[model samples]
Target: MIIPVIMAGGSGTRLWPLSRTAFPKQFIALTSNLTMLQETAARLDGLSGDDGISPMVICNEEHRFLVAEQMRQQKLTPSILLEPAGRNTAPAIGLAAIKAVEDAKLASASNELTEFPVLLVLAADHVIEDVEAFQQCVKSLLPEVQAGKFGTLGIVPTEPATGYGYIKATTSSGRLGRVSEFVEKPDAETAARYVAEGYLWNSGMFLIRADRYLEELKNFRLDIYDACVKSMASTQLDLDFVRIDKEAFEACPDESVDYAVMEPLAAKGEVVVAPLDAGWSDVGSWSALWEIADKDAQGNVMAGQDEKNFILQGSENCYVYGSAGNDGSGRLIATLGVENLVIVDTPDALLVANKDKVQDIKKIVSQIKASG
Candidate 1:
């Protein structure tokens, strides 16, 4: 059974003003009519197999209502798992895998299924324009995942992106290859060289058996494994959400899935990388958002409102994300001869930045938090 584990716990402050701490990017409709969370759930519509099961979502407790409401909008009643605090993806997925294993065991007792479920780990806020290609990539990795190989979908680099981490594959030319190493975000020159050498962007998407992931987690990070096990065992049902014990989960270490499992396992040749050429973007910053969005002849993307709302005289290659009716700002943003700028208008805040410096938007967010 290919059960999706959607990781939706992130405060997307980089796309700030639009994506707030209370209502992050995953819950916003940045791409299409559907919000990113809804799109994540909707993307699996046509995927079917005898072993396929419904999706399981792991999100922040603060966004529990938002998650539930978004899923309800799509008529998808997924098993929503709520974390007490943000412990990063490692513990979040670890606990989800543990719960999936328990559910599988219960089903086995009832003769529903005899095999362990394959967990398709996906981030909630990614934008993949090519759904068919994405599904094909996932289908291709199913057998390898069922065979106990940790399969990570690596995005084929369209550019030397310094925003995303790169996954170095052992072989350079195939759709799938053994992962050699995982590299952190690099400098511009280093990123360009990595692109030339054929390194894939670490997509953070994985397909692996639930039990297998638990086994590997136990082997690689016993502390995280044990904490997740304990937390899952004491989970409480709250309406449609499963709430883990706050104190128990609070004791868990904060780490990403890369550090807790994949990096160590990749070093041991246990992880495989599936190169995905599907148009994928994490939308890490305003510049990234501009890169993917459709632009006018002047290379300006006027979000929230239409071109009529944003009167760009000579603004070439700029992104203006104005306040929608939801923002309650009633603000109309207009640009002059500005080029390569990002103008975001919100109810409580407004940001105007250079496109090249958008990556450092997080620093401004950090400063705001520090002041408070």
Candidate 2:
């Protein structure tokens, strides 16, 4: 049995205005009909047959309703673990690992079960176009993972993307090899060099046996491991959500799973990289969305527009109307002649900026927080 753990905590300030603190990137439908979270969970359906395990989700306390609603729409009542605060992937997975261990215990007692539990941890915001191939890649890594190896799915780089970290791997130790190193997001030349050297995008997708992950967490991040185990054991089960003790969770250090566990385990454990070629995109920013968006003849995106009814730099495609939103204002914003512009219409905040300056949207988000 392999339990899929979806990590769905992100403020998404980079894709700001549209993606806010209340509604993060995971819930946003940036590229597809299905929201990113929905897509992430749906992608794992094929991998959860009778022999495999059902998915469990770890999300922010604020986002439990959104997570549960969406999962319910798909008729998937996932075991939801609500974090009191975001202490990064290490804590998120720590909670899920605890729950997965309990689940494994329950499964072991059941007459229908026949296998140990493997945990596939994934971010809820990622977009993977090729579902079957993604499952195949997960299946391929199961053997190593079940053997108590810490495995991560690394995307074969299509370009030198500075947004993502890199995993350096080679086939020196049987099928699964020791990770040479985990590098941070590199500069242009360095990213290019890493790509040339055949480094893989650190996709943040992880595979490990449920109980084994707990053991490693105990070994590496002892305090977090101990506290999380205690918290989950005495956790408050509220309907679909498990409410972790806030003081207990906040006491844990704010380190990512990669830094707190994975990176350190690189040398000692069977840290292998599974090659994922499934058109994966984290969609961390608005520009990332624009990259994958359908464009018009003038290379302008339909969602990109200049509001204020002012004509700016962009293809002069006649009257370009922006959605009159950001407060349900109902003000139809139309530009006569604009080129290379971006207009985002959200429920409470509207963004109108140069398309080239979309990356700077975080500055606006920061100001809003500063003013408060």
Off by over 4 Å in 1: 49-53, 110-113, 172-174, 327-329
Error of 1 at 187 (Å): 2.6
Q: What's the CA RMSD for each of the models?
A: 1.9, 4.0
Per lDDT, the best of the predicted structures is: 1
Scored by TM-score, the top model is 1
**How does model 2 score by TM-score?**
0.88
Question: What tens-digit string does per-residue lDDT give for candidate 1 at 174-246?
Answer: 4678998888788999999999998999998999888888898899899999889888888899898999989
The residue-level lDDT of candidate 1 at 96 comes to: 86
Candidate 2 colliding pairs: 313-339, 313-340, 314-338, 314-339, 314-340, 315-339
What is each predicted model's overall lDDT from 0 to 1?
0.87, 0.76
lDDT of 2 at 188: 83
Error of 1 at 15 (Å): 0.9
